[model samples]
Target: MPIHNADIIRIFEEIADLLEIQQANTFRIRAYRNAARTLQSMDKDVAVLVEQHADLTQLPTIGKDLAAKIEEIVHTGQCQALTKLRQQLPASLPELLKIPGLGPKRVHALYHELDIHTPEQLLRAARDGRILALHGFGQKTVDALVRSIESHIRQKPRLKLAEAAHYAKPLAHYLQQHPGVDEVTIAGSYRRGKDTVGDIDLLVSAADSQPVMAHFTHYDEVAKVQSSGRTRASVVLKCGLQVDLRVVAKPSFGAALHYFTGSRSHNIELRRRAQQRGLKLNEYGVFRGDTQVAGATEDSVFKAVGLPWIPPELRENQGEIAAAEAGELPNLIELRHLQGDLHAHTRASDGHASLETMAAVAKQKGLRYLAITEHSQRLTVTHGLNAEQLRRQIDQINALNDTLEGITLLKGIEVDILEDGSLDLPDEVLGQLDLVIAAIHSKFHLSRQLQTERIIRAMQRPHFSILAHPTGRLLEQRDAYDVDMPRVIREARQRGCYLELNAHPERLDLLDTHCRMAKAEGVLISINSDAHHPNDFDNLTYGIGQARRGWLEKEDVLNTRSLRQVKRLLTQTL
Candidate 1:
């Protein structure tokens, strides 16, 4: 019933997808897409802003027309334009957009040429060779389409961590507000800091389960109550995220949290250890010959097993138990450990905020330094900076640094790693900046060896500092490009550059496994927000989560260093 930021984002994005399918005006489609992006990167709720009568048009890429639509969505929970667009086209057409290679033009081509609409039709056409006959759908592409569809169909649906937060966080808070609730904690993959979550596991500890169960099932966001019981309920939220709530006895709360928050493999190993010790472990508590030993707290549960309490993020059966036994568990990096962000954007590129504004917000967020790394000119769609523009910006950064008090802006550019692995900008301009974050903007389908080589070549550049979003993945939308990540990590160590753990929710690149790989190779990772909006600095939270899951420590992250320390390190790369 309440309008959430995710709701608005979904509506606007759907509108864009539908419009693009209908072959609408390019700018119109872009307007909707950009508005959706602005909403995604922002920390504040648009509904709250609307309630305060804030000027929505002042939000980046939001115009008067889009503002009116936001208000409509808030008041009525629907968009009239999206409704009409659905009427004009098959509502199922938007599903085709989910196919990896199917952009609007391709979706339109498939629809008009092969009469494909839904994913089923598209899949059928691709398998039947109908898609390959279309203008741009080559044989290889058609083959890839079939595989992508098959994989997508077989894969379970999940929400990105940030999107799931939209549902889980608010729901947990709502449960906490109930009179009888003593404690509420979200468990499962959401608690484990996984990049994507299939469902949310909510555990409530209260003396009376009836009131809490009733409150949960009757919550406003519940689209349907699958089942309800005295102390448990299963419901699907309006956003298609499944949530299961269990009311645990106050004494078993920690055990319940441990059992439910498990990575099954980790729990299995723990149960095996308990068996060896002549103790039994389960959701209720640890027991020795029918006598309860430990269960009242997570720390107590771990103590019963002769292990220290492991952070939830590290409970993935990833050698964490062995490390705990050896007392070598990393003090995982936290959001507070960061002192600077090496890769970010401003209006000089596709970013929404100005340099000064971004600086102020970064300072307010406690970052001592923020790099303004505009996209290099090779990325024309973002109005990326040319050599001359970058030079002028370097001068601007120098002048601004002189007058600024708290946060210093570092001159940098996210130069594209071209197909042949050369840096997009020339050395003369790149050498003048404090740092250069080389990246790959296109050619995501290169062979694994080629992709790895391309990145290695880019990192070998004289002025290279970091590899931004090393894998070029957009969670749920696109898979990481085929590349040898371990080889790349070693290459980074050899070349004296670093890889970026891009913190954007959509692209938490450098998978947790890769983060561990980098750490082992003695390569520091710069956990950068890659912010396009001022508020996007909040994304550092997710970055820290991903880092902790990878078993990273404060020493493994580049941005944890003070400005003078970081500058000294950056100088080595240069």
Candidate 2:
């Protein structure tokens, strides 16, 4: 029943999409989109803000009109404006937008021209050769759309890591506060910090099981109780995330945690090892011929098989066991080792916060430096800075740096990589900044060869320092554009340019496998927040999880270096 920030953002975004389809004022549609973005980056809950009598208008880019809508939605769970727009348009037409390669313009044309309102209709139209007759729809586009829509329908619901945490963390805390509950751990992919998770597995160690199960089933967010038992239960949260809880004795807690927080293959391999050692391992404990030898803790389970405790993120059966046995397991990079963020935005571009606010938050978070990478002129929708604007921002950063302490703001730009494989901004302008983060804003549907070459060519530019969101993926909404990443990684190594592991939850860009490849090629990765707001800096944890999954270490990350070292490395790229 609670209206979460995600809920509010979702509604606002739908309103924007519907407005766009209706050919409404560009500014009005953009206002809703901007407000949605502000909500997405906000750290606090909107309901809590309302409860605290906080002014919604105070939020960045949120105006009086948008604030009223937030209040309406938070209090009533629906927005009249959004409802009105839905009535004006075919309600099912919005569903079409979820399909990849189907944007507002394409959907609008399909709706008016073909009366296609759903994936079923669109698929039929495509099959009947009706879609290709539309202005922008071609045979390739039709084929891609059919594949995307079919795949979208077949895919199971999953939550991004950050989205899952919204439910998982609070639920864990709730269970921890229950009477007799001692320890609570969320296992499964959530513990492993997978980019996306199917469900949350909660393990609670308690003196009694009834209290834990009762408390979990009655939690405010439990929308449906799938199953309930004395020591175990399964429920679906209001946010549509399924949670399974198991109560275990304190002594068997670690074994349970290890078993539940597993990559199935990892557990299979561990069990095989235990069998070789003439021991048995499971959720309950480790046993030697029915005489319980170890299981009180995960360390004991691993120790019984002569191994050290492996971090959950690395428990993918991806050579982690062999590495642990050889004592070659990497001392994975932690959040504390990060010294700075090399890619961020401010009000100078599409980012919600100001330079001062972002810098202060970065400093507050213990960062020594934060780069202010505004979008370059090519990205007009973001109101990207031209040469003059960038020069002024660079000057502003310099002035701010002189007046500040503890944190230095680096001048930079997330310059667009033109289709012809050139940096968006001219070299003379780019030379004025501390770093240049090249990104692809348009033309995501390029061939793998061209896409890879486009990025590699951009990296060859003298001032290009890092590739932002190398794959340009938007989690569930879109797939990564075709690109030969191995070639890109190798090119980065040869060019002395770096690759970014974008920390933003929606775009944890460097795939784990790609991160591993980058590391092996001696190409350092910058685990940057690509932050648009101050709180966006908190997304670094997701990036850290991804880095660990990729087996990256402190030495392999770029921003983990001292400010001086980072500067030296950027110069090397130049």
Top-lDDT structure, candidate number = 1
Which stretches in model 2 have alpha-carbon errors above 4 Å? none
* Candidate 2's TM-score: 0.97
Clashes of each: 0, 0
Model 1's number of clashes is 0
lDDT scores in order: 0.90, 0.90
Model 1, 279-311: lDDT tens per residue?
Answer: 999988999998989887899989999999999
| Position 364, candidate 1: lDDT | 97
After superposition of all CA atoms, the RMSD between model 2 and the true structure is 1.6
Model 2 pairs in collision: none
Question: How high is each candidate's TM-score?
Answer: 0.98, 0.97
- Model 2 / residue 342 / CA error / Å: 1.0
lDDT by residue for model 2 (282-333), tens: 9988989978888888998899899999999999999999999999999999
